[model samples]
Target chain A: MTPKKVTTTSGSVTGAASSFSWSKADTIRTSVAGVIVLGLLFWAYLLSSNTETGGRASFSLLIGLALGIVFERGRFCFFCIFRDSIESRKNNGFLSVITALAVGAIGYAIVFGMYLPDTSGEYLPPGAHIGPTSWVLAIAALAFGFGMALSGACISGHLYRIGQGSLRAIPALIGALIGFGLGFITWNTLYLRAIQEAPTLWLPHYIGYAGSLAVTLAALGVIAYYLLKSNTESAPEKVSGLAVLRSKFSPATTGALVGVIGTIAYMRIEPLGVTRQLSAISRKEFEKQSLLPETINGLDTLAGCVGIVTETISNNGWLVIGFVLASFAGALSANRFKFEIPTIRNSSTALFGGVLMGWGSMTALGCTVGVLLSSTQAFAISGWVFFLFAFLGVYLGIKAKVHTL
Target chain B: MSTKKISRVVALVASVALLSSITTAPSQAIPKNDTQTLVSADWLAKNINDPKIVVLEVSAEEGLYERGHINGAIKVSWTKELVDPVNRNILSQASFQKLARKAGIDNDSTVVFYGDNNNWFAAWGAWVFNIYGLNDVRLLNGGRTKWEKDGRPLTTAVSAPALGDVVAKKADASLRAFLPEVLKVAKKQQNTALVDIRSADEFSGKIFAAPGFQELAIRAGHIPGAINIPWKTAINADGTFKSTAEVRKIYANLGIDGKKPIIVYCRIGERASHTWFLLSQVLGYDVKVYDGSWTEYGNSVGVPISNPAGTVWGIA
Candidate 1:
């Protein structure tokens, strides 16, 4: 019998150990790396802690890893999901995302209410959690949502995808920083009139975490079941569950790990943030290095989010950077390494997209993660407003055909 | 295959370990100036109680300081800080020092500053401090607005004059460039290219913040022989500058090679700052941001500018 041949872009895959035929052993090796990295993170966050605050970091990482794995498996990127739903009229990815959000919200509410009682009125850990609502936040959300469509990824998604070599991400990130700066520039006027004037919207305290969680889970269940039933063909490609666990770690998988990272991110740092942290690094470098004037640095300077202070070397900043590098390693191990740069046609789109995001993030107060995800969990009005407006922006961008896609 | 995999793993482990060790010692390294532009909140929170840590809330609005400010911070009016409240341009060093002393800033005090509406004024002030050689200065990230929002302590108390010694340190007597720098660069056209970082209006002399040309008979455009490069083009929406590679591409797109000596300028030199830092510091290029900028040249007694759009001005 003639030897059958399968061709790939870089090389061909034949019957046995073809150049591109990823093996189970290879998958195991990558997964082992992931586990070891997660283990290191656990040691850093939980095992190292001695305070009453406990090892919240480990918990955050665990949760982020689990979520990351799930999202990766589901291909649950906000950009792909939202874009597919609006432009292509495909609903599977969109449905998955909505299900993920609902599931996340339900899980969080139950955990918060059942385990950690909020009797002591301390500020909540700033994590991949939620907070109150404001006009600024609403505007930022709308812009961020629009930005997600334009840039082809949301904030955290952009972070992971960068390792996969998406050129559009660079501009999107730049735009976020500009939006932050603009936010700083206009903060005073906004605060005097809108932000301070707007009432804070609390989720758990008002609705009761348990009831809210139950409602959320139910909502997700309904949506998932409906979407799944209506669109049978949209179900994700399944290998035996064990096979999935054994697939080579690609950017999609890295994204899921990021989810776990997000969980851990919340556990340690102020909140679950990828955009702000990365942008802040750029801002710090600019001001410190004097690449931009110190005056212009106001928007993202260290004082903006965490406070008007810093140590010799920022610990959280370095740790997150380390995570990004680790993610890069994961990407490299999978033989998928490329830098994503924009073409001329897409460059203009990027510039405009950046401009919108900059202005929008400023007005919104934060992006998808900060406003939408965090606020939704926190049960803030602006979070909901952001979600609605952002969805509208994404839809409009898709319909108008004003995007690179 | 196994050998390659082992090598890759070893390389990865070595690189990670190396980076982790290097990152342990974070540098306090910053730009060369009279003072540094930004500071962290952690720094502010720790030194909030220090008397010498004078925080100034400089904003456009007059009574913004009385509403809320850092515990001992005083409100310094931006209009009054350097402007004549008439010229809207660079203030005399003497006048600037007077305002500085009034704001409780001394020659020796480690000033940590911020202001309303994005802390631009504070940054501007920091820039000024650096020019004057006041070594200890930093900007608070997120500024006063964030501090107040986080429910960090804010006070409404305001203080008056405590005249302190403001020692004059003019390191480079020729720091404030006249028409020569532009003229020489334009005339020789050697390794130099003028980068107009000012707004289009200022470049065209449409809205005059400072007198650009008074002595030379130049038109209303950029330098007689230079490029019209806006500073904002270099920044992303997040108020962050583009990466080194991105910036390199931008310069290349403009046909201004990075290897060339680039001089950046704007209406009053404020906007040019972004480009100045980006090129010289970030990209490690041979460049200078003309802080005196267009305001000095456009309305100068008799300098020149290019009139028609897309026309380069050439001095006779």
Candidate 2:
């Protein structure tokens, strides 16, 4: 876990500066810190909320933190991992994401079954899919895939990288926001035919959580075997772009940790949805009267049309925000805070990207994290569709050579 | 060579000093009044009763306007009142004149707009007003629900003001989308993609909810050869648009030839208008939203139609 020193060349800055670089010892320490932070939050939630599910709450945060630490350390981002495979034909990162995803799906299925009280308990929140396929889902997945390539990151990356202060991450964030807004504007149409028409492919419905878990684990096993034996190879690095951020962290370690986070995210919150966190921000905006609610809600009701939404721990906004701050603290304590203003292209990308993301997230009903990871884990077909199309979109975007801005 | 060195040194010094001055000017400078375009509920809460201002509630629902609205605010039906049925795009100048007159809107009035949801339709109405040379209109960020949530002010009575004298200025053709213009873009084809920004069903002309829903059914499919890139795809789940990268992804998925023009459209044009804002104004696409959209083309006698989701529609 020794941190690898990296050299970066910035037009505006001189010397080989590293951001988020931590020694192996530093990573382990920060991960321990992550555990402590999660524990403290769990304690606070237990004390504050007068709910009987305190144990579940505590476990969820603990697992989520472990996952976050692993993810941060390994850089288990769908966009980055997926892009490595496509652009450079590097299979290691791609296989890592697939492996984590398989592990998560199976792990959640087993956990849900072992823990579920009954059939009704198996019912997941609206975008939390275990796998259902629909045209809308397909389109969204492809689009998400495309987004990852173009932006060079996914929703999760944008969220965590805020701590690293990567200027390009800002544009990516903005793009996500704008995508959500536009999604809201066009919700009515997508909902009526595409979203509504698509069948929910919930695992619990057919085989129960236990059976689903078994199948998921089996699938993961198969995938891991296939990936491990494949002829795919990692690209030779002239210099690691992430080397600066690689303190006690390496992509592999972070990837595995993210798997843990994904699991905890499911157990605690409804699921690990990065897009919904963004959605909550929009909802708050509507509530604040910054944007119109009824129109926005009615336009993209599928995205915003949560009927009888729980105001409890089901909301991931608090957790996402808390995790981000904790990440900042972790990087700072490790002496890995690189807070450089991004190049002009990077800044514009953030602004414009945020705006586009706001629009797209609204129309698509979720982002990569929200629909792709969370819902895919839940076995929703649409979730898969979103992931696939978004991936395609990202690929096309990258291929087209669109400037960052 | 010495002269060149002196110039470089002087340029370096001047640039440093200028950068320092700009950077040191303000870390938290409060923007001026004009700089603040969106006024929050707190601002409207305090200024609701101001004599110089007028509030208007524009919605499709009828009795809801009567049931509850900001006090002294007038009601305008976005579908019926704000737009001309024939054009189904921008309101006719003559119709706008009448509606403005009925709402007691003077050219100089500082009109604030809000509605049930964050004033989306209302904002659209306000935008129309602004485009028509009305500068005093502003959207109440978070709109009616926020106001009601905060218990700001409400009245069950709808205002009936004495009609004001508002004259008709010809429709700003520059601010509108017409068939001729669309046809021109359509002919260009690859350089231009018609974005039927309606729902996937509307674009595919499938899953009709009601029979004889003429407005909903005009021509059931999308434009003869346009891409069904709904405006909604631009936003996130929480009702905000996706970020710029997300947007490019959305468009790129739709096979949006960025080098070409993208024209977005919907049933009446309100939703498409938002897309127009995102694409042309925000993403900087050479984009135009078809304000007339389905309402006009679908109902048109000669326009074509399709059914059963054959072409690329929905998220793909």
Candidate 3:
């Protein structure tokens, strides 16, 4: 029997039937998504014109658009990246992270150098949290890593995934909100005892920009070497421009581009954050206000995922709205948007994991993006501390999954 | 005139002259030996019962005092009591006098302030007390954090002491910085120094305004030439004011001698007031609180602004 021909994104002629099936349904979905995006843009324009912060909100909306597009196209997510890297032995996912970090570090150094020259001893980045390094942060990171495994997506990942109609993420998001409240309830004791006096070590504070960059690059190089060593798959063939947009990006390409974009977002708007938005939703509903201490153990000193609660959507909130909208649009265009009610067990796992994520993020003062990426680029000890622990949690979670399966 | 009267008058005149000479020391703005500016946790615990010192806990958030506060310290919400609800500005003299009476402070009562966040709002309390012309207003050394950290006791008991006889004075212009005064300092850039006592982000214009609060300003930048010295720099890791020497050095290293006129501003002057307390009360610097701060300055049109991040007008 003759094999069916596939019009491949990588421009390769394949023998097996293609997994994706595009149809008139996808065309209708894409059109609706496009209209909604236009409506959102118009609404953003009107908002910016009326309110003083509307301009910022509008910018966040655009940022959301870019974030959604890249995330959907690249399939950028912690779980997928880590899973492919570890289990599938896919160098692409791991290479993407290394590239993104390397690029992000350079971008951060450039912006950091310009904004703060010899001022590190005096000035902290406005919204960036380079929280103190302590045992608490380490513990929190481990929980965060574990939570991501259970929940199936990091906070931001779930947000963008929602655009693609990922139903399991809904419970996870809800669980995260509960987790934030729990974190707030338990904050004072933990903060007063450990975080208040925790030693905050900044790489920039100790070593110059060049030194930090060198160390960051070296770490990435070592990881990349391992990620690529055992994999014998050759580089995928490149497609033309339009096909490229539809195709899933290689990890390195996605990582580098996202890194640059994330850096710009921090410099221009605010750091990429989602936990704060979740926390905000919790605060908006929890009218038993005063759940948070006014000072919050100097939590007010840093901004990310933590903020004053009001009805108005924060800048991060706007970014979140944009992310979901654009991702949905992107997914539909790529014929990838699908809605599914997850199984009871998987749904329960996502919800449980999400709660842990919320709790862990609050305890550590940020989620994956806020701590591991934004703060890491700032050379915060909290960033690295969270990263290592989260990685461990992810590893252990994956191991537990193998046992369960 | 009697010879004895002449001799007594002459003695008083001589003492005044000696006091003036001592105050003339350029290095020391106020007497170095004067320990009345700050009361330690132990000192406060000991003297809290004296009935003359009204310990007040000022917080930016509500219900903090109910959580756990310094014994005998009444909760003073910076938003509710200290500020005028209608204008969303500082309280008027009449309102301040009423607040003073509510706190059970008499004309001669010494006010010692304490609160959480290392007494961030407590310093604002001290500043408010000073504005009301309260004599001997002091901040609790190390605030409630140190007191709590050291296992000091906290009481949930509410105090409704006898009404205070204190008279509220008009807000002193010298202790406050108005737009005109700030503008003059920004333009002249001389004997006066403007201290942007906010986080580096606020100073750098990386963020237009503080998070949690509405963006009060359209522009994200500091007053032109204002130095970015965060208010926390005045604090110890334990949430207490650094030693006078350390604080003095902090300002001195920044070329701000307490002798020179200094203006400090933050988002809404709450945090700036903290710096004002440290500089004026603790280090005895001639510092003024620019209560309008970035909210006012950032919104003002045609005013020169310095944004280190070069972030402005929705552009990077």
lDDT per model vs. reference: 0.54, 0.57, 0.75
RMSD of each predicted structure: 20.4, 25.1, 22.5
Q: What's each prediction's TM-score?
A: 0.45, 0.45, 0.56
TM-score of 3: 0.56
Candidate 3 segments whose C-alpha is farther than 4 A from its true place: A1-29, A232-234, A287-295, A402-405, B1-316
For candidate 2, give the docking quality class from DockQ.
Answer: incorrect
Q: What does DockQ come to for candidate 1?
A: 0.01
Instruction: Give lDDT: candidate 3, residue A110.
Output: 80
> Which residue pairs in candidate 3 collide?
A96-A251, A96-A252, A126-B201, A276-A305, B105-B164
- Sorted on DockQ, best first, the list reads 3, 1, 2
**Candidate 1 per-residue lDDT over residues A1-405, each given as its tens digit:** 000111112223233332245677667657665775666565557533634333434443444444333333344567776777666556665554554355446444543442234524332322323333565666666676677677666665655566556676677667666655555455557666666556655555556666666665565567656555554233223233333333343322333333343333343344444444444544455456555433433232211122222332343344444444444445544544468667876755665576566556545645565556555544445656777788888877777666666
B98-122 per-residue lDDT for model 3 (tens digits) = 8888788877677778877767788
Candidate 2 lDDT, B1-316, residue by residue in tens:
6754665466457545555434322112223123233456776665554433568887653335544577788877776677666753567677687778777665545677777533558756765774565546665655666665566766655455545555655554444567767766655534567777666766666643123233444345666777777655765543444566777787878787467777777776676766665565445566655666776666667644555554333323
Please give, for residues A238-291, the per-residue lDDT of candidate 3 as tens digits: 555444435677565677777887788777676777677778787556546656
Q: TM-score (0 to 1) of chain B, per candidate?
A: 0.62, 0.63, 0.85
lDDT ranking from best to worst? Answer: 3, 2, 1
Docking class of 1: incorrect
List, residue by residue over A101-196, the lDDT tens digit for candidate 2.
666676566545433324453344332434335665565555555555556667677776776556678777767765665555465567666666
